[model samples]
Structures are given as C-alpha cells and as structure tokens.
Target chain A: MPQGQPLTVPNDGLTTKARRNAPLLAVHTGPGKGKSTAAFGMALRAWNQGFDIAVFQFVKSAKWKVGEESAFRELGKLHDEHGVGGPVQWHKMGSGWSWTRKQGSEVDHAETARDGWAEISRRIAEERHDFYVLDEFTYPLKWGWISVHEVVEVLGNRGGNQHVVITGRDAPQELIEAADLVTEMTKVKHPMDAGRKGQRGIEW
Target chain B: MPQGQPLTVPNDGLTTKARRNAPLLAVHTGPGKGKSTAAFGMALRAWNQGFDIAVFQFVKSAKWKVGEESAFRELGKLHDEHGVGGPVQWHKMGSGWSWTRKQGSEVDHAETARDGWAEISRRIAEERHDFYVLDEFTYPLKWGWISVHEVVEVLGNRGGNQHVVITGRDAPQELIEAADLVTEMTKVKHPMDAGRKGQRGIEW
Candidate 1:
C-alpha cells in the first residue's frame, strides 16, 4: 500500500474529506502484545491534537502502576498548567469508575465491569471525549460481564467525531464486525518463548 | 496465554529472572497501522523506568511532523529539569544525525539511511542507550539501501541489556529470524478503504 493512501476507494457517496474526518471505532485484538500500548500511543497523538482523551483500563489490577498512566497523568497536569496538550483521564477497573464513584462495597469484578460499561455508555451518549480508549475491554465482553450487543449498539450510534479504540485479546466477532478498523497483533515470536520473565520497563 | 507467562519455556538453562531481564530485539512489521506507535509507547515505558532512549527515523521525511516527536521532546525536558524520566534523543533522516554531524551536501536518501544505520551500529557496539527505536528502519533494508545481513549480525551480537525495536513494513525475513519478538500488525479494516484521507493527529 502507498504511504498514507488507501489501497482501494469504495464507491460510497461521501466525499473523501467527509469520510476521512468521520468518527472511527477501532478494535485491536489477537494473542499478541501492543494492543493497549498502541491505543495509548494513539492517545498521545490525540492529546497532542488537543483532543479530549479518556482511557479506561479494564481487567487490570488497580494496584498495577502502568507507565502510560504516569505519563498521561503528567500530560494532564501539563495541559492544566501549561496548556501544552489536551486533558487526560486514566481509569482502571478495580478502582471505581472515574465518572461514577464507588458504592462503598467490596469490588465485585463482574458488577464493576458492568458499571464501567454503563459509564462508558453514558459518556458516548454525551460525546464526553474526542478520543476514548477502552483498554483491555475485550475480556469483560468475552466473559459476559458486559453485553456485546449493547456495546456494539452504542458504538454504532456514537454519532459524532468521537473516536473509540478497544484493545485486548480474543475480541468478540460481533465487535470486530462493528469496528471500522480492526488490527490483529499476530505474535510471530516472543521473549517468553525463551522463558523470559516480564521486565519492569519493557513488559509493563 | 497466561498474562506475563510464556507458553513454553525453552531449556536455555538461563534462570527465569535472567531470561526476563535479557535484552530483547523486537520487530513490528506488516501492512497495518501502529507499528511505530506501539514502539513509541514502549519507549514511554522505557523512559519511565529511567532507561535512556534514542529514536531514529529512517525513511520518513524530516519535514513530516510526528506527534510522538514533540511528546518525547517534552518528556526529555522533564528529565532534564525534574529528572522524572530518561534522556531522549529523536533524530530524522534529513537532518544531520545526533551523534555525527552532517556533511555540507544535499540529502541523499540511501546514503542518509546508511549513515543512520552506521550510527546505530556504533551506539549498539558501545551500549549507548538502554532502549533504542529504529523507527521505519525496515524500508531501507527492504530497498537494499542498507545490508540486512549486517543488521542481523550486529543485532544478534548486541551485548548488554540494550533493548532495540525496529518498526516498519516489509521487514526482511533475516531480521525477523534474528528478532526475539515479532508482531505483524495485520489490517482487518482501515478507514482509508472507505476512501478516507489520512487525518492529522491520528495518522501523523
């Protein structure tokens, strides 16, 4: 494919610019690394463009300190203090949804995931952010904690210039079908095959 | 696969921690998006861990602006002031290399690429950076502007805990064979297929 050019132009009636500026729903899946990392990378771009950025990391421990979290949090501060970039909000599953506070009960993984989806659903309806990253969200859908049909329905009707990217392994077929851009990160080889333990900087 | 666990551990006789801490040579290739994006994301993680970073853009025009470049430049500043992260150096092909000054001559694409490889090779030999990103380096190798055999040899013999990641399309088979981790970003769907032009912020 030519750099920055589409392989084939469909016979859709929309003009090129209109189609290019349309909102996109992207899903990054398959049994490989870089799904969430790539989503975060896109978030960096969106932030640079001054697009509102919100990242919801599902199925990861709240205690886990991801490098992206710190980087984005700093970027958020930079936006607030220096106005260098867009605002950023990073939320994880174990922690209560950032939009909705916890109900003061022990965390139930399934219920928490459902609440997370509900919050995201409400945000999509309101067009809360220009760019949204549902990081590692596929696990909840695959485990039936969140309804795939409902998720797809909301995403299909997002009706704005709001882009959403979901990242995780084994994405549901329905979700893939609804997505505008779907990438499968196929692992040809990995360090773990040599029994490498996950390192601090590279793995996280 | 289990999170952070290898499917099968080879009997390389190295301890688990040693294997885990071992430097990795990763390749992100194929006809899809996020090859460079994911590499930058990894660079962010490496930066947070205080790993020195050096990014070399091989094939892209220096006139082109990538969001990651600005973001990393800012992070590099944060490191200089508050010392929050690692030092960062970003270089493009058109400009003189960071390590080597430019000769007073017009830009030659193939020669510039070879110069970039030579600098990276010297850095690798000296273990200059903890993490290195050879962004879009595969294009030169694919075009025979640089020797793929030499690259494979240098990378295979790269000593110390220096991690290197090369991102681009059409990676040579020899480089893939030499890499410890290879991820092919296969495109299932793309916005361009709908006759969309590359949008700023997202595509850049």
Candidate 2:
C-alpha cells in the first residue's frame, strides 16, 4: 500500500483463487542464477506434500554434479527406506540418453531432443508425475531441436492437476505465452563482473 | 557455440575461481516469485557441505509454515541425531520480532526492523554462521526501516568466509551496488493473471 493509493478490485480476476485449480506451466528463464534452484525448491515443497516428483535436465552435463541433484537423490532414498515422502525421479542431460560432441552430429542431437520432448509430452498426457521440473529445457527449444509449437499444444491440453516448471535462458515466446507463470532472472551485478569464480558446496 | 562463431575467452573472471573467499553480499530482488525459495536452496547446499546455516525471514507471516523452513528444520534435527550434515537455525519475521498490524506504530515497526538487522549485523561481524539467508530483507531496507548505508558498509568490511544472501522485491540501489551478486526476478506472467489463488504446499 503506497501513499494515497486507491486499490480497486479487478472484476476480471482477483487472485481471490487460482484459475480453476488447473495445472500450472511455469518457466524460469534468464542470465541470472537460481532458476533451477527455485524449481528444485518447488520440487522439495511438492515432495513434502506427498507429490511424486520428476526432474529432467536438458543442458547441464552429467559430469557436473549439482547439489540439488544430490539432495533430491538422498530424499528419494529416504522415501524408499522410511516412507517419508513420495517417489522421485531425476534424469540429467547425459543420464538416460544424450548427444555429446564425440557421439553425434547436430542433426542427431536434434532428433534426441525431439525424442525427449515426445516422452515428456506423453508423461504429461498420462499424468506421470505430480510435479515436473524441466530444468534447462530452453536450449533444445531455442536450437530448433524441438518444436515450441508442439510443446505449447501438448502442455495446454495435458489435462491434470500436475505442475510443470521449465528453466533456462531464451525461453521461446510461444512457451511463455502458454505458461501460467514465467520468471525472467535479470542480472544487475555479479561477482564474475568483478573477477570471481564459483566455489564448491556453494555452486553445486 | 553459435553458428560458425569463434569462441573467445573473456578477459573478465570466468568464475574460474572466487575471491580469497571473502564474505559474499548477495541480493535476490524483483517482482517475481522464488527470491526467498532460491536463497533457501542455497542454504540447503551449505547445510549439505557441513556449513552452519542461519535463515532469518523478514516478511512471510508467522502463521505461514514455509516448506523450506520445515525441510531445513528436519535437516537440523538429523544433524543433531545422526550428524548428517550441519546445524541449522531458522527465524521468521514474527518468530524473533514482528510488525503485525495489531502490534504497534509504523515507527515501532521501523525500530523493530532496525533491531532485527542489528542482530544480524552483529552475527555477521562475529561469523556466527557459515552461510546466512536473510529472506525478504530488502523490504525493510526499501521501507526505510533499516539504513542501507549501514548494511552496505558492514557487509563491505565484514571479513570472513561466510556467505550472505538477501532477498525481496525492490532492493535499494546502494545495497545492490555493494552486493557481490544481485539478481532481479522479472515477472513475465503469473497465475493471478488468470484469477488464481495461492495453492496449498505451492504458495507455502
């Protein structure tokens, strides 16, 4: 409430309630950090609520061990051993299937990406996971490996209470338009600008 | 690697390495969601690495049981019981000090905010925690409750390996300039745009 501000209720929509309890399509895109971290935060919340979770990374190499990946994997173990929460699935760039420079051509990479999208689309249609985190999915879409139009169409009619979150830079316009939520991380300043590198335990 | 583009190394620090591990003053601000959530994610990483974590939340109500808070609390309990990682401390806006409409005047709220910041400043100076997540701290700075100059000066001179993350919307300019890292979370769209209310486990 700012000074002298008259608040008028929007007849159109009052966040009085979320739209029809429909599933959400969220995108986290930009140059700044924390996009994936935020999505993982959401996953953590969903997991606490007993929602099955699925995490699929599109760009970060499997060779690079991320902290959230490790944390979530541990949580998955806890779920299995102690019945603390729901099941968890995590698939990184090179884990399930991948396109490395040493293994394939750009065209081959394109097909693999398309195949990944198709699987994800099918999962959405079948309501596979309660919450899906599509980490760094923008690179493939931006590189033309996957069709943004198809993604928009599939997500629009996924038909479930499942939530989806996509993270990366250069998110396609069509996807943004279709998403129920989108966050663009803007970098105002960075330690790198002043000569700094990421440290362990902090970055991963 | 863009089309036929020659990759040149940036003369700037490539996060090739971080500074002499000086204490970091990081800010997460803007109009979108995830600021506090991302900071909590960092706390999770720090905790995994055996770093003592302190989370001081400035805004979200005392009644609100944020998922991250519950998760970290559980981790803390594990640390005590099984030495799983490190110790964790979480204090929300109303838990330690608060500005509930029922409590007092605007000036009183300002004083409480200043006191809260003072305690945090003292902890930073004493290196009480290896990592500090000052959730929604920017609101106090923006509302003129805490002195941005003082916050900036202290952080600039606070010599330790400890890392600090401040989060909220509309961070002050002086604080942003002083920060080692600053991210502005721009909102592209929101569920509220389509008449949605915060859902359980989701908004919390």
lDDT of each: 0.85, 0.74
Per-candidate iRMS values, in order, are: 2.1, 5.3
| lDDT score for candidate 2 against the true structure | 0.74
Error of 1 at A110 (Å): 1.6
Q: Could you give candidate 1's per-residue lDDT for residues A56-124 as a string of tens digits?
A: 988546534378888888888878888988999988876566666664256677888888888888989
Pairs with steric clashes in candidate 2: A17-B196, A17-B197, A18-B196, A18-B197, A67-A204, A197-B15, A197-B17
Which predicted model would earn the best TM-score? 1
- Residues forming the 10-long window of minimal summed lDDT in candidate 1 chain A: A95-104
Write model 1 residue lDDT over B122-194, tens digit each, in one string.
Answer: 9899999999999999999999999999999998898999999999999999999999899999988887776
> Which portions of model 1 miss their true places by more than 4 Å?
A7-11, A63-65, A98-107, B8-10, B63-65, B95-107
lDDT of 2 by residue, B1-204 (tens): 011111343565533333525467789999887887778777777777778999887763554436777777777876887787789998765633532333433335566667678888888889888999988788888888788898888888786688899998888988888888888888888776655655655665
TM per prediction: 0.93, 0.85
